[model samples]
Target chain A: MTTTLSLEQEVARLIVEALHLETAPEDIDPEAPLFGDGLGLDSIDALEIALAVSKRYGFQLRSDDERNHRIFASLRALAAHIETHRTA
Target chain B: MPAEPAFPLTARAPGEVLFRRGAEPVTTARFLAEAAGLAARLPAEGPVLNVCADRYLALLGFAAALMRGQVTLLSADRTPQRLAEIAARHGARCALSDTPASLPLPVIAPAAEAGPEAPNPAIPAARIAAIGFTSGSTGEPQPHAKPWGALVAGARAAAARFAVAPGTSIVGTIPAQHMYGFETTLMLPLHGGGAGHAGPVFYPSDIEAALAAVPAPRLLVTTPLQMRALLGTGIALPPLIGVISATAPLDAALAAEAEAAWGAPVREIYGATEAGSIASRHTTREEGWEPYPGVAFTIGEEGASVTVPGLPAPVPLADRLEWCGQGRFRLAGRLTDMVKLAGKRASIAGLTRILTAIEGVEDGVFLAPPDLDRNPRARLAAAVVAPGMDAKAVLAALRERVEPAFLPRPVVMLDALPRDAVGKISRAAIAALAWKR
Candidate 1:
């Protein structure tokens, strides 16, 4: 699989692991919302997700990041985040 | 490691004040000599409770406990019931308290003994050196046993991580009897070439005044809850070499502000009663929690299982972690804190950690409404102590930094956050208070 697709799958797995999504990884749409009604992620989940990504990718997840809400907006956005920054 | 004799301790420096506060301070060499004197005089058998009100004497008892092969039992609220529980658990026949006359067990003033001082040889470790009670928010109080070698190792590790400059006097706001307080304030100061303040520090003003009592290059050891209070009060303190915060999460922003206010590096030590402090973070926003040079980490489900460079195997963690490389990792809160909301996973501990870090907040706690499922919009209710700022103000500050979903709804204003002995606030307690509103 391409890095983009792989990253997308990894994000799905992480969302499932972090928030314990009931659905399969493939069931998650990249463009669907993660924080709002789409996947229902909250702040605590955001921290867990952010820290997990930082540890796996090697850099802090800055709270001041302007595109934070958008980056964490969906599986696809998160996957793209991982794609641009995966040290591991 | 029993007294192997190969690595015998030196004839430690005399008058090297082990701890000093008020008008007097203790020298390590003097303290060690006194402990040796106490060792020479203490009965060969039966446990002696130590409650020397004078921090110096209590510190002497601590060193004496190590040297004499006696077990020191500690509890901050050493009420009659707790004392009785402690004495019975250790089969103690005598108790050392500030007031010797009132103790249930036989008590003695532990007269200051004098002798030509000499550094004690490495004795057989433990044989059970110290005992303390758990936070006990769970079940019947559990006892945590501290071995001598482990105590020595923990003290040395903390000193090395903190790098107390010479002549540094360590002062404390927490009781010296509690494990966290005992290990850092009482023990670390001695081993790392410093002294402990004699008087007890109660309020933030008390801490400020006590800081003045101790000599320069001072280390003020406290908790996140207390640090928040200092930031709120905006007190000008003495020249603090470093600040050691433990027993609770020190929010990054609050920590940074404290560092700014005191003009000293605020070092947060990650530790617990079960395991002594093992790691240090110089900055709140610092990404990695560095293990004391000799401490090691191996990440797993229960968090990071740690093995000090020479420790046998590795011990597991009760908290979560973001295991980074290069002998450092980010620490999340306790595992028990991970919560489930309508089958959605989140961490109440993490939420609370973030809450207290918000500017102007003294102490903050986040609780999931018991009827969370019933009230979808209920979100999370919080009880906060923000003295100068109101709930909306705190919410606005949090909104400026964090996401909208995490904004604490219906923030309950409290004079102070409720915490048990170990300074932990339970979600159940939070919910119970929210119900009142």
Candidate 2:
């Protein structure tokens, strides 16, 4: 559980750094939505995050993949996906 | 009077494929049949607000409206407020949408089921085929009328410029409602003797899938933003004949990289909603734009204005141009304070108006990043003098008023706006404040 929490924190930092979000990484709710109503991020922000994630985790996030809706649902979901798929 | 020329200037054999709907090829015969069927069901009287997310359905709606002598209103801004305003302004009787929408008028989804082939009918050259709306400086959506003949001429010119030959498959990332998308993806194929892919290609994967779905020789109609994301994905794309980019200025470095990766020439189109596509350039090879055939430019003290063959009068351009002689010119700078991001256009002044209109917002200004055109991640920034209001509240308010693409990020709170002796705050001041935050 601690390891998962750290991964989520690392991802939160990455998101803030990549997207230049004004929100602090520690303030981001891990289970809250990252798009639309939650973080107010849009498609452009998604592309930026994907590029950052690819560089950090060494895997591509294809935009049209059906799993994207689940993978990008929240900070926790994205962090979990990275934990399973990260090679770097 | 002499009969008007047919709507599609260039005609292909009935059996030839006109569009690829997903993986299935839709022949010209079938498309005409579906359009005719849709047209038969449309109300016989007023203009139509076409909000179809599917390119093929939008084309069908457009064709049906043209056949019925009803002008089709095209707007990329499909927000309920904007759609309602457009419908009310144009007295639109109905809206044709593929997906469910809470629109003001009656919504009709044109049946995609194939019907019996129908004969092609001639539409009047003078008939207003479409009215494209762009955000005016005053915040109202300005309407630009496009006649069927003009649209046909514009498409033919673009086809010749890009060498979009018969059997070429065109796929686009931009939505079909915008003027550039309509001209390149929809109109170009109808008149260019090429087949189009009915795509809502937003993401990199979608672009790759759509391109792979259609047969080569493929032509990618996209903006610089999508091109950057697609290239970043490092995904192998199908062999493309060529690439055509527009809406925002394409960076020469990015264009060169795209050319190197795809082994295809990257061409940039210079046009506007007011005049459609007027010029093209091989981005890696040329610094100046070559105007399309029958497109003449006049560079005067005021700015540049282009005279196209089919439009009734010369349309003034908002871009300052340096004439290179023989109908060629270089884009010097933009005359208006318009900012384009992710293929969406919004004037800074208009955005500022919305920012200040919020109660408790004493003063504010919206700042477009200096590198917005070249930087894919560049976003609009704002500095608000809203006491007791947080950035989240300001952003939430803005999200309601503007499209997601135009929402200001990092809304900086300021005690007071920095104004000069004349009581005018320069853009540099706001940009600096937002940058500091």
Report the C-alpha lDDT of model 2 over A23-50, residue by residue, as the tens digit: 8999888888886556767667877787
Candidate 2 runs further than 4 Å off:
A1-12, A26-38, A56-88, B4-10, B421-423
Output the worst ten-in-a-row residue range by lDDT, candidate 1 chain B.
B3-12
Q: What does candidate 1's lDDT look like per residue over B61-136, in tens digits?
A: 6666666667787765444555676777778866665553465677756655666775755655435567766533
Candidate topping TM-score: 2
lDDT of 2 by residue, B311-391 (tens): 899999878899776557998877778887666667989999999999889999888887775675688999899998988
Residue B280 of candidate 2: its Cα lDDT?
92
User: What number of clashing residue pairs does each candidate have, in the order they appear?
Assistant: 17, 0
The DockQ scores of all candidates, in the order shown, are: 0.02, 0.35
Which of the CAPRI classes, incorrect, acceptable, medium or high, describes model 1? incorrect
TM-scores of all candidate predictions against the true structure: 0.62, 0.91
- Evaluate model 2: give its lDDT: 0.84
